[model samples]
Target: MGSLLDNSLQIISNTTGKSLFVRLWPLSTAPKGIVYIVHELGGHCLLYDVIAARFLEAGYTVASHDQYGHGLSSGTRLHTSNYQTYVADTLQCLEEVKCQYQDTDNVLLFGHGVGGLLAALLAAQNPGFVKGLILHGPIFKFLEEHASTVNVCWYLSYVLPLAYSPVNGTDPALLITDKDQRMKYARDPFIWHEGPRLSTIHAVTTAMGDLEQVEEPLSCPTLIQCGQDDQLLNKTNLTAWSKRCSKTTKLLFYEGAKHYLHMDTPECTIKVLDEMVKFCDVVRSEAASDTDDAVGSEAASDTDDAVGSEAASDTDDAVGSEAGSDTADD
Candidate 1:
């Protein structure tokens, strides 16, 4: 186990002037990298405690923030004016974390549910900046039931954007197979029980559409994890989205897992964490290799330049000596 340093909380304002609740878990020793956790919809940063602890033990500094309209952040619960607001808020939070921990430039993004979508967008927008992406049950396309309501929600947003309807929420049982875990999730005060507002639904759908139109493939390493038993998403969609990314994209499905793989049963949760740690290690190794390759290429280029210059100088001297000898013979 790695030694823990003092954990701290910070409040940063988003573009809309809402204060985002930021949490930093720094390691006592030099960290291998940084993992910025992005929570699912209706969930807060605290929901990532288990995963964050594991990352901390694995020598990573965990940085997270309660997004606008979630947890301790200032906004309407489970509501956002636009999907871009979430992206903007997350980008700002990441920048602040990067600024604070300038020593550790290597960073990975761990996002869950809709947060996964946000992370993917950020990684795509800023190519090569993020080393890797770990998406836990990312919601690329809504379940059949939710997709069916898209048209209705878009129409209703103008009239009833603030309406709290049952369709906007999910069954807790579908989220976790373990009864205890499901109960705990339902009971968590920080997690909003109320469904997302109609306006929020519109925002999410718009964002999903935009994601499909992203022409450039995500260049960084991406891990797309899904549960075989997840009722909220379809494996086909995840697979299709992975194809849009670079060859480094990995799609893994847990046999008996559900939506919240990180918070699933002990056996399943352990497997998820272990896989995540392994992925991070692999990404770190690849990054180191790339750096070494770059340095080697630069050195080779310099050596070639030096050798070419020396040969040119020698040839010039030989010609000058021959010319002087010829003149002396004359």
Candidate 2:
């Protein structure tokens, strides 16, 4: 955990003219890169304030926005027509970040839960948008015990899309093991305490299903963090999906931790932050190296052109001198 710091929030309009609550934690000096966070389902960007500040301290500019239908964003609470809306909104946010921090080209994505799925999809589909990804307990596939719930959501999606059904393991107490952290989540007024709308569940599950069928792996570097004891997802399935989705993916599992690894314990949270910082540093260095190599190649080409031009000038001068001498002798 990092020291508590001040941050600012603003309201930005999405492509569809929907207002989204955007926040930025900028560094006093130039940042190594920019980290854009995507919040989980039913969660707000403010929930990631601590982690964002930590990145700020590590010399990174952090930016995030509450997705449509969640937090201060304009929409029905915990609802969206489809998962693509979230992806489009997130892409808009990335564009906005680019405009905001034009100096830094290394933009890393940090996503949690459903947001992780969105980040993975974007990184896979759009390779040049981000430098790396840090996924905290992303839900690519549901556990076997939750298959029935997923089936129900899919069925209701065709008929009663707005119907509400209790989703297991959504309660703050169940997701967060620490009492203080649990209460913090429970008491957050912006959080949706009721069951998620059927359409929202359907959108997420449909996206997951699509990812499961993808044959191509993500092109960028990816780091996945999970709690070994998380009750919300199947570890085996998550591992398989990570291997399938990213050829350069790294996995880190916290022992005895639940869904919320950051809220588990101070030690665990620090370790998570450390790993994230290290990964970002490596990616930033590699990106900088690539830029340098390109510049060097261009410089070498210019030098070669200059040398060739000088040699041509010398040859022309020598030919003119020889002609003048021959004319004098004649």
Could you tally the backbone clashes for each prediction?
0, 0
**Residue runs of model 1 more than 4 Å from their true location after superposition:** 1-7
lDDT of 2: 0.83
Who wins the TM-score comparison?
A: 1
lDDT tens digits, residues 152-253, model 1?
A: 888888898888755644568878878888888988999988878888888988888888888865888988888999887767888888987865788898
TM-score of each: 0.95, 0.90
Question: Candidate 1 at residue 276, lDDT?
Answer: 96
Report residue 286 deviation for candidate 2 (angstroms).
1.3
By TM-score, how accurate is candidate 1?
Answer: 0.95
Q: List the residue pairs that clash in candidate 1.
A: none
Error of 1 at 117 (Å): 1.0
Question: On a 0 to 100 scale, what is the lDDT of residue 273 in model 2?
Answer: 88
